[model samples]
Target chain A: MRKLSRSSGDVGKKITETIEAVSEAIEDTLVVSRKFARQDEETLGNAERIIDSVLRRFSRAASGLTESEELLRTENNAINYEISDVFVALQFQDRVSQILALVCDDLNKLEQHLNELKSQQADEGSSRSVNVEQWLEELSKTYTMEEQLTAHDGTKAEIKTDQPGITFF
Target chain B: MAKTILFVEDSASVRQVMNSTLTREGYDVILACDGQDALTRLDGSKIYLIISDVNMPNMDGLTFVKSAKQMPAYKSTPIIMLTTETQEVKMNEGKAADVKAWIVKPFQPAQLLAADSQLIQA
Candidate 1:
C-alpha cells in the first residue's frame, strides 16, 4: 500500500469552502424563486381580472341568451377553481424554501465546524473529530417537519395531498 | 360587512395566495410579512380571526400569539396557524398561546376556508 499524506487542515478548508459555496447558491436560488413566485401571482391576478371583465361584458351583451349565460358562468367558475388550485400548488415554494433554509443553516454549521477543526490542526498539530451520533441528534432536533425526520432516518416519507393536517384546540 | 382576518406569513407568495383565497370567500384580509409586522397591523382593528405561519423572521408565530392574546382588543379572537411545522411540541406551544387551530402548509384553500367557517360564525 502506498501512503499518500494529506493534512487535515487542507481537507477541512476544502470542505468548508465547498459548503459555503453551496449555502450561498441555495440562498440565491431562494431569493430568485421568491421573486418569480411574486411575478407569477401578479400575472395570474391580471389574467383573472381580464377574464372577469370579459365575462361581465359578455353577460351584459347577451342577457337574452339565458342558457348561454349560464354556461359561460359555469365555465368561469371552473376556471376560477383551477386558478385556486394553482395557488395551492404555488405554496410548494414556501415549503421548499423552508427546507432549503434549514439545509443552508446546517451547511453553515458544518462549515463552522470544519473551520474550527482546521484551526485546531494548525494550532495543536491534530484536529478534533466531530461525534457523528451527537451531531446527528443535534441535527434531528432542528427539524420541524415530519418529512425531514423520515428523510433523515432513510425511510420513504408519505406524500400527503389534499389531506389537511388540521388540529383544533 | 365582511369579517376581517389578519394573515401573517413571511413568504410573499403565500401571502398573495391567502389574500386571494380569503378575499374570494368574502372575508376582508390584512396581510403582514412576519410576526413583528403583524403586531403593528393589529392596531386595534376589529379582526374576526387570525391566520399565521409558525416560523418567521423577527418573531415566531407562538410568540406573536402570546403577545396578541395579551392585548385587550384581540383577547378572544380565534387564531389558526398555517405552517409547515408538524412538531407536536410546537403545537402544544401554540395551544398554550391560545391558537384555536393548526393547519399545515400546502393545505387546500377549501380546508382553510372550512376552518375559518368553523371558527368564525357566519
Candidate 2:
C-alpha cells in the first residue's frame, strides 16, 4: 500500500510539469502574433505617408503649370499691343513720300526756269537777271505743310499735338 | 451689298495698307495709283465714297474732286482728302472743292475708321 501511494505522487508531479510547459507555449504564440501585427501597422502607415507626399507633389506641379499659362497669356497680349503700335508708326512713310514728291516737283520747276533763263540770255546777248523775289514767292506758294514752311525759314519745326487734324465741312 | 469705296493715292504702300484696313472693315475697295487713274474707275458705277491724296503724279486731288463733282453719276458723292498738307490755304482749297473731310498723314487707322463711320452708314 505504501508503494502504491509513492507512484501516485510521482504521476501528480509529472502532470504539473506538463501543464507549466503548455502555459509557456501559449505565451510565446501570443508574443509572436503581437509582433507581426505591429509590423503590419508600420508598413501600412509608411505606405499612406508615401502616397500623401506624391499627391502633394502632383498638386504643386499642376499649380505651377496654371501660373505659367497665365504668364504666357499676358506676354502674348503685350506683344499684340506692341505690334499694333508699330503698324500705326509705319504710316509715317506716306507723309515722307509726299514731302519728297513735292521737293522733286519744285526741283523740276527750278530746272525748267533756269533752262528758260539760259535761252533768253542766248537770244538777247544780255544778262537779264532772274526776279529773285518773284521766284521766292512762287516757291513759297508750292509749300503745303507747316513743317515745310518752318524748314524753309530755317526755324525749329513745331511740336505736333496729340490731337489729330480732322475737319468736317 | 457691300459699299464700294474709291481709294486714290500715289504711294503704293499707303494704298496697300488702306486697302487692307478698309477691306477688313467689310467695305469693297477700288484702288487707284493717282488722281488720273481714279477717274478711269469712275465709269458711271455706284461709288459710296472717294478718298484721295492731294499731291499725286498725273492729276492732283483738288482737280480730281472738281472733275468728279461735274460727273452726273458721282456729283453728290462724298469726298475725303487724305494728305500731308496742313496749311490753311490748302484746307481752304479743299473746302472750296466741296470735300467732305480732311485727314492729315500719318493718320491713325482708328481715326480713319471713326471718320468713315461718321460719313458712311453701316
Candidate 3:
C-alpha cells in the first residue's frame, strides 16, 4: 500500500499538467482574440484561426486530463486531496510553457503578417470598408505565406487560423 | 524472484517514486489509484503482499483491507497500512481487518524494504 500510495501521487501530477495545459490554452485564446482586434481584418482572420486551433487543443487536453484525473482517483482508493494540490501546481509549469509557446508563435505570425500588409496598403485606403477589403485580401496572401512556411519544413503546423476577426474597439 | 507486491495509492508524484523504487528492488509492483481498482487488479495476479494507504477517496484503506481479507486468495496475504497519522483507534481497526503491520508515513524506502522482508519471512 505504501508503494502504491506513492504511485498515486505520480498519477495526480500528470492530471495537474493536463489541467494547466487547458488553462493555458484558454488564456492564449484570449490573447489571440485581443491581438486580432487591433490588426486589419486579414490579420484578424489569421488570429481567429489560431484562436480556434488553441480552443480545439484546449478541449482535447481538457478531456484527456479529466480522464486521467478520474483514473487516478479510481486507482488510489484513498483520498489525500491536500497533498494532491501541491503536486498539481508543481507539474503545471511545464504544460503551461508548452501551450504558451504555441499560442505565442501563432499570435506573432498574425501580427507580422498584418504589419506587412498594412505597410503595403496603408496610404492607399481612406474608407473603413476599403481597409476591410484590403484586410481580407491580405488574409488570402497570408494563407499562401503560411502554406509556404509549412512547405519549407516537413512539420505539419496544425494550428487553425480560419475564424472571423474581432475588430478593434 | 522477488515476491509480487501490490500498491494502491491516490497521489501521483508519490506513485512514480514508489513504482521506480519498488521496481528497482526486484519486486514486481502493481499499482492501483484507489481501493476499488485495487480489488479489481487483485483478481488474477499473484500478490504476496499488499501495501495501501489510509484516508483515500472511493474506498479507504481500512475498508479495502477488510474486504480483501474476506477473499480466499488474499486471506493470508501480509497486508500493511501506511498512514501519516498514528491514531491508536485506526491501528486497532486495522488489526481487526487482519493487517500485519502499520508503518507511519514519511517512511524511508530502506525501512519499508526491511519491513517487507521481515513480515513476509515471518
Name the top DockQ candidate: 1
Q: For model 3, what is the error of residue A155's alpha carbon versus the real structure, in angstroms, after optimal superposition? A: 61
Stretches of model 3 off by over 4 angstroms after superposition:
A1-169
Binned by DockQ into CAPRI classes (incorrect, acceptable, medium, high), candidate 3 is: incorrect
Q: What lDDT tens digits, residue by residue, belong to model 2 across residues A1-169?
A: 8999999999899999898999889899889989999999999999999999999999999999999999999997786566446545665655656668778887898888889989999999888767878877787787777777887767977536364668999
TM-score of each: 0.74, 0.64, 0.42
User: What lDDT tens digits, residue by residue, belong to model 1 across residues B85-104?
Assistant: 88888988899888899998
TM-score of chain A of 2: 0.53
lDDT, candidate 1, equals 0.88
| Per-prediction DockQ | 0.48, 0.43, 0.01
lDDT for each residue of candidate 3 in B12-98, tens digit (9 for 90 to 100): 666676677678778889998889888888786568889887756799888888888888889998988766433466778888788
The TM-score of predicted model 1 comes to: 0.74
Clashes of each: 0, 0, 33
Q: Could you give the interface RMSD of each candidate, to one decimal?
A: 1.3, 2.0, 23.8
TM-score of chain B of each: 0.96, 0.96, 0.94
Tens digits of per-residue lDDT, candidate 1, A1-169, equal 1233356667788999999999999999999999999999999999999999999999887786887779989998898788767867777777778889989999899899989998988999975888889988999999888888998888987747756579989
Q: List ranges where model 1 is wrong by over 4 Å.
A: A1-64
Question: lDDT per residue, candidate 2, B11-111, as tens digits?
Answer: 78678877887998899999999889999999999998999989888999989999999999998888999877888888999999889999887666667
lDDT per residue for candidate 3 within A28-127, as digits (tens), equals 9989987876677778788899999999999999999999999998775443333344333433332234345545665686687777667767776642
